[model samples]
Structure formats: C-alpha cells, structure tokens
Target: MFHTLKQVPHSIAFPASNTVESGAAKEDQAISITYDKSVTLVRINCPRQDGHDWVIEAFTALEKCGMAFDMVSIQPGEVSFTVKSRLVDSVYRSLEKLEVYPDSVTDCVKLSVRGRSGQPLLSSMITMAETLAQCNIPLLRLVESYGLIEVLIATGYISEVRKALAKNFNC
Candidate 1:
C-alpha cells in the first residue's frame, strides 16, 4: 500500500579497477550501498503451522504502530524484518500483545553491493565478509537476492565496516 513512496537511490557506483584512462574510461562498475544509524532488526520465530498467520499479524501491528519497515524476509518458521530504530519500543510492545515475542532484537546497519547489470559477484560479498572478519566485527545476519547482498552488522561497528568497504571499493 505504500509503494507510492519515492525511490531513494542507495547505490554508489565505482570503477572496478585501479586503471584510470586519460579520457573516457571503460571497465566494469561496482556499487556500494550503506544503511546505518536508524535501522533495527526484529526477528520472531513461530510454529511452522502458524507462521504465515503470525506474519500477517506482525505486519498489521507494525502498521498500527505507524512503523515503516525497510525489508522483510521469512524462513520456514521465522520472520525477520528491519524498521527504524525509533519505533522499536512500539513494535516490541505491539508484538508482545499478540504473544509473538521476538527471538532476538538487535540494533544493526545494512550494507549492500552489486554489479551494474545485477550480476551476483561473489567476490564482492567475500571481500565484505573478510573485511568484517579481519576487523573482529560481528556479522549478525546476511541476505542475498538477485545479485544484491545485504548484511546486518552490529550497530557499533557500522563505521568500521563502512571504512573497510570504502577502502575495498576504493571509493
């Protein structure tokens, strides 16, 4: 129902290689997208039989609380969603009323990377994962679809993650 919102561009494109031509450049491009500071992740695990119904109820609750979510993913018996951090309390209370307490609620930031033509370049994702690993930053969750990679990382490490990604992408 909220599809009318204007699409905000989140990806920044960078040259794939270090070579710089004197004039026009020709090379593959990589995109870097970072979402930090106002994001919170909410996860709920429900009985498989009732997972679908619970998901609907959870969305209704979020709507009732005037919360806007950025993404939602559902597994066999788990439902995870991301929403603005400011509404965490309202969302938590709303879910509590339905006996749908979250399995884990944590503050996180999202970073994504993709190729120009939506190609799933495994190397990009690996670079990000390796960078976080090397820095001792915890990766809370990761999701990849249609060549887009999204990672939820500890809020405290968002800056460090961004720096690492920037260096890798040479942005």
Candidate 2:
C-alpha cells in the first residue's frame, strides 16, 4: 500500500522544497535540510469522498516507499462553495535523543574558494553531507546552530533545512 520514494504519493507529502520547520533560522552557520515534495499542481477531478480516500491512499503508498509526511489537506472547489478537511496528518515526534555537541559548542564551515573549478569543492561537500546525515543529531538542533546551504545534503534534515534558509535570508 506504499509508494516508492520516487513515486511518493501526493496525498501524504506535499511536493515542494518548502519550509518544514515552524520558523526562520537566523544563525549564520546553521545547516538546513529542506525536502522537495517536488510535485506540481496539475489537474482537478470531480468532488467526492473518493477523492479523500485517494489522497490517503497516496500518503500510505509514500510510507511504504521510505518517504514520510504530515498534514494532509483536501480541498474541493465547486460551483457553489469550497469544502476542505485534514485527511491524514502524521504526529510530530519529540525525538528526545541525547545531544551531539551540546549548545555550548560552536561549529564552522570554511570553504576554500577557487575561481574556475568547483569539482573539488563539490566532492568535499558530498562527503561532508554524508557525515552530517550520519551524525544522528536532531535536525532542528543542527539548524539552531548552523544555517542553510551550510549543509546541502543532510539526509535527515533534507525537508526542513532549505526552508530555514529562505526564511532567514528572506530570499
């Protein structure tokens, strides 16, 4: 009943590279992990409860495919009026895991600037991204410490990180 990560159902996940976190990240060194719900709003269908079920089906499919999401919303636009409901929303988890470096520790991302080539830098970035994903530290904690584009490929924070960046930079 689940979908592949690539075929992640639109119901369970909103396909966008939008902010997952609740607020903006202001620190300069914060690393963000925003996800790409990545799907576009393409078409519309007839209004019916079956549409609600369809959305739920998509979300359940996504879960089987290794993708998770929350806050399912269904909206029906009719010639008369619009109706909406939250069909399926995943509960927020506190995680409550132990600290990594703790709040007292400060980190930095020092990039070696080169004029023409970015391969070396990209390679280095990929490695670093893998490491960050493995850290097992809570993503919000990492972001509270560092900023977005600071951690491009953090697997765990992929959904929330990019959002933090846009909020802080106002871009």
Predict model 1's lDDT versus the native: 0.67
TM-score of 1: 0.64
Tell me the spans in candidate 2 whose CA falls farther than 4 Å from its real position: 1-49, 68-73, 77-171
Compose the digit string of candidate 2's lDDT tens values, residues 1-171.
Answer: 112123211111111222324454322221222232221111223334544554444434444544443222245621111011111111111111111110111121111111122211122233334444554433211111211222212244443433432443343
Query: Which residue pairs overlap in candidate 1's backbone?
Result: none
Q: Give a tens-digit lDDT track for model 1, residues 1-171.
A: 113222215444544543333443445455646455556788888834753887888789878977787668888788888876777788889888788778555666666556767654544555667778888888776767765777778778866776766675666
lDDT of 2 at 55: 43
Model 2 earns a TM-score of 0.19
Q: Considering every candidate listed, which one attains the maximal TM-score?
A: 1
Stretch of 10 with least lDDT, candidate 1: 1-10
